[model samples]
Target: MSKRILITGAAGFLGSHLCDKFIAEGYEVLGMDNLITGDLKNIEHLFGNENFVFHHHDVTNFVHVPGQLDYILHFASPASPIDYLKIPIQTLKVGSLGTHNLLGLAKEKNARILIASTSEVYGDPLVHPQTEEYYGNVNTIGPRGVYDEAKRFQESITMAYHRFHGLETRIVRIFNTYGPRMRLNDGRVIPAFIGQALRGEDLTVFGDGSQTRSFCYVDDQVDGIYRLLLSDYSDPVNIGNPHEITIKDFAEEIIKLTATDQKVIYKPLPKDDPMQRQPNITRAKEILGWEPKVDRAEGMKITYEYFKSLTPEELNKKDHKDFSKHIRK
Candidate 1:
């Protein structure tokens, strides 16, 4: 009998990659997604594979999968600021209610569960180079709080399940990750900037562009997550590239890489936006023996090529212009 794993949010950027990884490892992968932020194109290639099956269901509702299961990876939440802000209630619900549903499902199946947490939990840090120990400075009523607090609540309940119910649980704090299959108009920095450049539009820099982010290639993130799922350690572990770069410098780097003459334009920064974000992977290194092998220069080039492969309509879509629609709600 082959191992079986159920992965929610399996159609999203990271989740799709995980589906590929687990299937490659010979696990019968049962993928689920609501398609609110996920696109079918990401996982379309796996449609014909015998080892893969997909469920077009929302994790906020009760999730049911027939038969034995060995693992459940709960990753079904609106991750980007644009999507979450537009659908704030859904974001909060998915992270809180959606996670609760998955936890209950995990208990019923007796499968080990892994929930994807984010670096945003360390919002607008008072401490530099964020560690897992740092309690975040977040405005609960602020706009970004929809996603941040939901994830914080996710971590809380997951720990509760582990302690009270003795359900096996794992949490991974993911940082800035980019690669192919990302929605060009999702409004994340990498895809936004690349979309702008591909469409010959000016790159829009929010604020003075001093905010920093560390980019982890998708492969490295999945590798770390896979290891964390199998590891005995239950506490949250930060899984991301520790190398940090500022928005201003990163914009300049993108311009250089694309060799585009278009200049950057400025926009007002949103509220509660973190000034810095870099993961402290001391635990990941010691435990998983893992660190990102792909550098920004290498990763960005690959990401850029992916953006270039999209249709002109996708590249030039007006939705990428977060103009006033997503301005802190």
Candidate 2:
């Protein structure tokens, strides 16, 4: 029988890609998502595939899988700053209660599970180029705390399960990733800048744009996740590109990529936003033999093409949810 795997948040960008990867590898893929921040369009192509099935469910509630499961990729949560800021409570529940539900299901099915973690755990790092050993400098009460804390808690519970229950588990701290099928209005720097350029608007730079980030292409990210899931090691690993760039420089690069004449404009930086975020991937290199393969120029070209293909309406819209009212003072 083909190995079966359940992927939570399967309608999401990364999750949908995982569904595609597993399905292509001849594994039976069961996808579940509440569509809170995820879009059905990401996984719409798989609807007719016999090896792929989907459930419309929230992971915050009890998760029930009916058959023998070989693996679970727990990725259900509000990922972006905009989404989490808008629905902070749900974000907390999905990470805490949702992760607990999935871990329970994994235990019941005897499945190897991997939970999606983020570089946000590092939270304005005092240590440059954060490594797995570095304890992060996160503010538990900040606006962004809802996401960082939830992920930290998820990791804690996952580790406990691994130690006490002896369940097969993996944790991946994903860094900034971008690619095709990204929602143009999701409010990440990639889509945000691309959308602004496409609409002939100025690129908005927060806090003089000196903050730094390292980006990995979606394919590279998925590849790293796949490798980590199958590896023997159980500790947390950082999976992301190490090619660091400043936000100001990134904006200039986007302008060049889009061939737009618009200049950048500065605004007050959001509270608790990280000043630097780059993963130290030595653990990943040694353990999983994974490194990001796509360079920014090549990856940015592909991403730009995808966004350029969107409808004019999609190009014009700010976001599906009007979270402007939720902006913290």
Task: Go through the candidates in order and give each one's C-alpha lDDT.
Answer: 0.90, 0.92
RMSD of 1: 2.7
TM-score of 2: 0.97
For each candidate in turn, the TM-score is: 0.96, 0.97
Give every collision pair in model 1: none
Question: Model 1 over residues 25-81: C-alpha lDDT tens digits?
Answer: 999999999887787888999999999999999888888899998999988887888
- State the displacement of the C-alpha of residue 40, model 1, in Å, after optimal TM-score superposition: 0.6
- Model 1 error, position 301 (Å): 1.1
Candidate 1, which segments miss by more than 4 Å at Cα? 320-329
- Angstrom error at residue 297, model 1: 1.0
lDDT of 2: 0.92
- Candidate 2 on 98-184: residue-level lDDT in tens? 999999999999999999999998999999899998879999999999999999999999999999999999999999999997777
Using TM-score, give the best candidate's number.
2
